[model samples]
Target: MDMRRTGAIEAVSDGGTVESIATKMGNSIDQNKTLQKTYMLVNLASVHAADESRKIGRKNIASQQNEIKS
Candidate 1:
């Protein structure tokens, strides 16, 4: 084969490799963003649950105090 043909083949191969690497990197970045969002949602849910628990405890304490007064 001629040198020009060999060079063309090499160029095409390199382009494919670069494109594949870029695609993989993009996918990895997307995955990281998704994971971060999921973690944030989980944290928010935990905080909400804690708030609800505190509210219930306060209500129970108020009930007990009223009972003692009665």
Candidate 2:
């Protein structure tokens, strides 16, 4: 929150209008929310990918035992 307020102060110091600064802050918040959602989705995808890889690499002990009986 302080970081955002400080950014607004900097924006105003750089001659931005109050309305534009407020809009920029709102846009930043929305962008952060979107980025957070994307971050979570990426983490979820990675976890699922890892699970699938593990499944693919797993050996079937029953199949191996049956083959040995042949």
Candidate 3:
């Protein structure tokens, strides 16, 4: 993955063809993009789950406090 685009860029900079660069790097670049998106989604889901757990804990504490007051 790292080798694909960087190598392509280097090749072009060194006077290689632009015509096949995309063909050479396309699949790896796409895989990298998909991986990035998947990581982002997993991170978001983890954060959301953590926040929901915190909310539920706070609600339980509030109910317990009200019970003691009564």
- RMSD per model, one decimal: 20.7, 14.3, 12.6
Give residue 5's lDDT in candidate 3 (0 to 100). Answer: 40
TM-score of 2: 0.34
lDDT head-to-head 1 vs 2, winner: 2
Tell me the lDDT of model 1 at 11.
40
lDDT of 3 by residue, 1-70 (tens): 5655456546555665544454565544334656334322334457679989999999999999999999
Sorted by lDDT, highest first, which candidate order results?
3, 2, 1
Residue-pair clashes per candidate, as listed? 0, 0, 0
Candidate 2 lDDT over residue span 1-70, tens digit each = 6676556556545666555754766654334655334322334457679988777666566568779999
lDDT of 1 by residue, 1-70 (tens): 2443333334434553433432533434224555324322334457679989999999999999999999
Off by over 4 Å in 1: 1-42
- The parts of candidate 2 lying over 4 Å away from their true place are 27-70
Predictions in order: lDDT: 0.50, 0.56, 0.58
Candidate 2 local lDDT, residue 4: 64
